[model samples]
Target: MNKFRCLALISATALTLMACNPASDAKPAATIAAPLSATAATPAVTNNSSGKIVVYQAFTRLFGNSNTTNQRFGTAAENGVGKFNDINDAALVALKGMGVSHLWLTGVPHHGLVADYSAFGISADDPDVIKGRAGSPYAVKDYYSVNPDLAVDPAKRLDEFKALITRAHQHGIKVIIDIVPNHVARHYESLGKPTDVRDFGADDNTTLEYSKHNNFYYVPGQAFELPDIPAEFTPLGAEAHPLKDGKFAEMPAKWTGNGARAAKPDFNDWYETVKINYGVKPDGSYDFERLPADYANKNHAAHAAFWQGKELPDSWLKFRDITKFWLEMGVDGFRFDMAEMVPVEFWSFLNSSIKLQSPDALLLAEVYQPQLYRDYVQLGKMDYLYDKVGFYDSLKLLMQGKGTSSEVLAKHAEVADIDQHMLKFLENHDEQRIASPEFAGAAEKGKPAMVVSTLVGKAPTLLYFGQEVGEAGALDAGFGKPSRTSIFDYVGVPAHQGWLNGGKYDGGGLTAEQASLRAFYQQLLKFSSEASALKGEFVSLHPLNLTSPGYSEQQLSFARFDDKQQLLVVSNFAEKPVSFNLQLPADLIKTWQLSAAPVVFTDLFSQHQQSTNPAKQHRLTIELPALGSVVLQRQ
Candidate 1:
């Protein structure tokens, strides 16, 4: 057989072992040829001693974009992209007023884009390879650069982003950007990379398909081919490109980012990117030494010691340098994308270096494996992991009336060991908006869910930008469909723009209903941040009321308390009003040390007061409004 045919035959057979565990399928700007105006690397000084964090996630391209066209597959000029400069002091103050502690600006990295940026020494990205008119932010092109799309000057993009970071800090909000370690754009090139740092694949031996030191796995002797485009899905609204004719010239095709081994990956595959290898062979055996089992209970110092004087994979070292470079730019923390796909050993090395630099550096990750939660947090040194499969998925079901709040109690029990490290969120970029028809189809339905998510544990609370003003994710923004605010397209968010009010940041144009929803979010989040009870021990009233007539399965009531503050949090997920004798268990009464005298409890959320003697009567007849939540504080 010919060399190409022989390679293809062998590559196809190898995919069975390589493809079984692709990290995750769930699935930017500017800058100079050199580093921007910044001092030498210094460890960032963190001010999160209070131990409560409320992160506001904003799609950088769409956050300040006032363009209302929002047409399907619109170009950047047509859609009017938001710049780093667009997020003014007014915006920062407004976000801070909404009880934000951190502003996580998504899509800050320089990724493959459909727009031409060749004037800046950047190569033009083919739209055929891109997922949207604006490309997928996950398919990063350069590790050292920011996306020109988010910059007003493009050349000064890095400086503009730094200024925004400064502005956020001034407003008392820390900043977080994404770090995608699992993959990079198929046409990855780092023009802004340091002179000393070697480019990926610079010294790779491509004759072999797999190697311990190779940055990427190879389909030797085969040229890369583009996935066939479907009739319904057109690149850049059917716009033509010189490089869009189903051909890309990689001498030895690298394994696809999602682990597809074919020269031409399926259209659904992550074909725009190439996966990074971290010493895992084609047969799924580790080529690098594994950390000891006892390392799971060890701290970052111990983990760091394990890697000292040890030779590591090139990909691991390269990613470490990239992360350290960002940290030096005064960026406080990182949100690692698809962290589970990368090996935990690499995370231990990477996160230890991060913590060693800045001990309080927030190393949040997108890790879905419940079985591997403790491993990632305790051993991998991750500060927080996305609680999607547990709380988020359950909340969605509860909102749809298909599930009960009992799941909340069950999940807390299941993840109690890692409770503090499981970050709770409702509307992030990857999930559908609560107002979307695919979800609850109503914004108010999110109220109860938000209340519980924020106070469930000592975990951080997260909110998407438009989620406050009830921005329904129904926009037809190019490659990404409705139900999610598109991270891959240039589009204006309608409701968020209403709050932006043409960059006034005054919420001048918001409807009364929208205003109320945003107000509710502000109050709840503010309470969560300041409340001492949220950091206290959790006691789910679920088990005590399992047989009570007043406690429906849709209802959940719990108490979080310490000596200084005690809070009774109750939520009714039902559509109709429900009355129940809210039961407090004897263990809770003794744990909290209830007094025999009548204790007046006032609802912080609704300001409704109730006087009940808990010592004499352990249960109180309480009436909960339809689809509502109340936070009662002892008076």
Candidate 2:
């Protein structure tokens, strides 16, 4: 019986073959691996075109314990191997000083299993049980490897380790890693032997469903559904369904006496507890018609192909062996994990594998679902994902002050003319905190209406790792209840501060309303990285004079043009001062311009220039203080 117990007793008699249907002519089961060839490979490039970014993606594990050692991107314990050049050259020198390109480190992989390490808060003088415990690096056992306890080498391997996309492309920044291909790891490591145990059911040799490639790819037409459990085989949790923790009694055949072979072959009722198999390839190209070729590593051909999550063939050998194994280590781009459920065949295999690392590789997909620009550009599949309906419709219409700065520059020029569909955001670690109880404190009196949801841009805005240093309470991977994520907070240490802005505010720039909302979000992301018609678009959405009082749900407006330039974004969600109406345009009175309360410009894509003053009035008349916003220019 040894040999991993004959492959766990033929994978536990494949759940008794669902009690009946064994003969559709039965036969196929004893296969092992081989036959794959057609390597071709190389494809995948995307840092998403056009621009506008403050893109942060510093996602620490959402609750469920998160303090991995050599903590991947939070190292500094004097660099015991803190990966990616020890915490990305001090957060890319405060995002190239506010004008950021991209960062997205998320969870760098190689964690075989700590699947839930008793939620890491462990007390009573600590005792790291559960084999180097930590949590949710998206539960992957090995999407290829690399977590040598996160580098400094736990015995090396993973192509020798470390490159972090060439130190974030020497400094142009742009790194993104997460890409977790669905699910795989219920104590994986099973392959073959244990002295054979076949029986797609010649009528119950202790039944078990069919073994080996069993039901082939399940798609005779599509919409599959299988759950028979005639009761008594129990099993529902202990990780069989894999979505992250489960129950229904952990379905081990419901309770056991084998009632109808535990409901016709396992899977407790099903609702995407996560086993996804539909695969069919009449020729569309995901062929697994019935696998049986490889006889046990006689050469490996991916042990006979199977696309598993539908199709995408080696997906550029699976996104170019993790960008040539993080470009040898300089690491630049990959943070995907469940990217719109994967498959544009994997972003046209990542646009031809990062086009020879041109402009420094970037693909970043953890798309936090918000109809992401019509689900990756009108249902075409994916180029990137995470726009939550244009960052919560520009943070819920500038905190319900309801559209106007010309409907917030016509909704950031209607999703900022392509070049990459929205990723812009305001608070992360899923819900709550953009100022707690979920914006119900009007995000600290709408800090300039959530700083115009980060300089109303065209993509790249994410931020979440205690967002600009001010992360308060409540929001441990929300959905409610148990919480514990860490990279140090409840005293383990390291919050550092840096980009949290607003100096003079005691102790530091984070809680004087998060340092005056990080001095208007570091001068509106250093003005969308030096504005070029706000990074594309030579002006549009020019509607002026919006009367106050009610002003369509409190005050929301717009104005972004390019005939020399005009920026007039105003967001005021009530609570006091407000007055609007800027009906100007008499040949620019020699190019009008006005600035007050901290204004600094120069945020680029190609090139831009702005310097303004003079406009106390000219049919113009604005005042937004009291939970406000205003950015007007023309020079």
Candidate 3:
């Protein structure tokens, strides 16, 4: 079901249930027992060069917008869109205190917005083709400019965005921007494009179905037609739109973004965009030469060397120039949208060229196919890929009380070979909120999951802007729906907006429960970022403690060891207390090379101590509260 309509049904069901049992709407005392404001002060934050890497994903336009009008399908004038000037020194300092190492500023690049910029010599995007009044961030209209909606002065948008990058670096956090190379808006025009660079379709021959040099595929003797709108859908929801008619102007219609070759695409298809040609023929054959098998093991420099003398396609060079332009502008890296749709060879060329310019530039891709994971990382030179098909989906099932904790271990084991290259995240722009009714239905349920996801591996961790504050995505955005945050419209996030606290960047007006939840997230993120043992070898303790007393299927246990210290982590996902004898495997002790000695173990999180004589057998009795996480360190 569409997320927006699905939320309407959810809302009706909730209202009915509330009416049926009025008393059930009251908050449970157990979960609502936090102080009205956070009592304990956070520790001082410093730049730790060797800490666990963390990425904070913030929607560029929503981060500093304090407007609460929240008009559905609201215009910029009504809702007051956040500008690049809003993210000031206070914002970066707050993010640094949360242990953020990287800042992913989504929707920073210039895209199709409904606002009229005709004064700046920019054409207005048609409402029939745009997703919302603000438009989808993926529909790139100009590759070399920043979104004017995010700047204090529309003429100085690019300069304002660069200043934000500089501000992020001052707080010891790197920056990442989106690079949507798979497609472009149907009316792609680069008004601010470089003088030497040509537009996407400048030289394309529209007469042929497929050509080695053509930038797009065209259907001869056909005119572009709008998709059939559903009976219930409206362009602006009872508001007048000047360009809402079902007509667009494109002679010899090109293929849709999703490879739909028909002149008229389905409403469900990505009809607002057109696919970019990457030398792949209509029969799914590659015209460009594939990289050698040995290139998989070679560094990016070697890969760059192999492509130096080759005659690359026009699309390939254009994208390379686009990425290079951003890299030069101080964007630390990129998150490629729908990366798998484009050929891996093009990525090999693009990424290698990227590394040739800046070796430390991060490259993350959204690739769902498991079979192509290694190919994309190894041959495509991608630094990380989303773990949605396995780890994320499995965790969601467990959170909804439909699966066991052992399945999480199994999911990790399945991706053991590529675990270091698979980034883990509890929430992002694409997923439902943990506190939403469609997911776990409570923010507290995400505690154990977040603990494991952050400390489970060497890969980087990600936290969406409002996740720590338990922002339930329940508002009805114009085109996007509830459950997941609206990437298509202009709206303010309630929980995160509270954290903004009217530009103070503190939780000034949050309820007791929210304060406590934010505190929990703060402690967990800080601990994960500073722990030394988390960067070393890991072994699953769950396999050895399954049969122990008081152990259940809702418990997960693991150990990480390095040369100087060893850490034992145990998390309880159930609603009841658990007391169990967690046994350290004989093999684990032998691997640690410990002689017959009494090891003193200290709980880093709870400040409890225990001494276990492992001369004969290695075991310790552990007590964990409901939804608890224990991190014990042995020195």
- What is the C-alpha lDDT profile of model 3 across 1-635, one tens digit per residue? 12210111111111111111111111110100011111111111122555577888999888888888888888888876888878888988888887888899899878887788888888888877787778878889899898999988888888999899999999888999999887798889998789999989889999987787788888889998988865334437666667767688889998877666889977766677887887777766567777775676777778788888888778999999999899999998999987876777888889989987987787888876665667777778888888877788888888788888789889888877777678899998878899999989888889888988888886778899989989998887666677877877788888888888878888886878888888888877877677767667889999778989799778888988777668888888887789988888888888877667777788867789986667547678889988887878886
Better of 1 and 3 by TM-score: 1
**Per-residue lDDT for 167-235 in model 1, tens only?**
998988888899988788988888889999887888789998888889998999898888776644564
State every prediction's TM-score relative to the real structure. Answer: 0.92, 0.29, 0.91
Q: Which whole-number lDDT from 0 to 100 does residue 63 have in model 2?
A: 15
Write out the backbone clash pairs for model 1: 28-147, 29-146, 29-147, 29-148, 30-146, 30-147, 30-148
Error of 3 at 585 (Å): 1.2
| Model 3 stretches astray by more than 4 angstroms | 1-48, 231-235, 594-596, 613-616
- Which candidate ranks first by TM-score, i.e. highest? 1
- On a 0 to 100 scale, what is the lDDT of residue 469 in model 2? 43
Q: What C-alpha lDDT, on a 0 to 100 scale, does residue 408 get in candidate 1?
A: 66
Task: Name the regions of candidate 1 deviating beyond 4 angstroms.
Answer: 1-51, 614-618
Question: Against the unseen true structure, what C-alpha lDDT does each candidate score?
Answer: 0.79, 0.39, 0.77
Using lDDT as the measure, the top candidate is: 1
- Model with the higher lDDT, candidate 1 or 2: 1
Q: Please list all clashing residue pairs in model 3, or write none if there are none.
A: none
Give the clash count for each candidate: 7, 82, 0
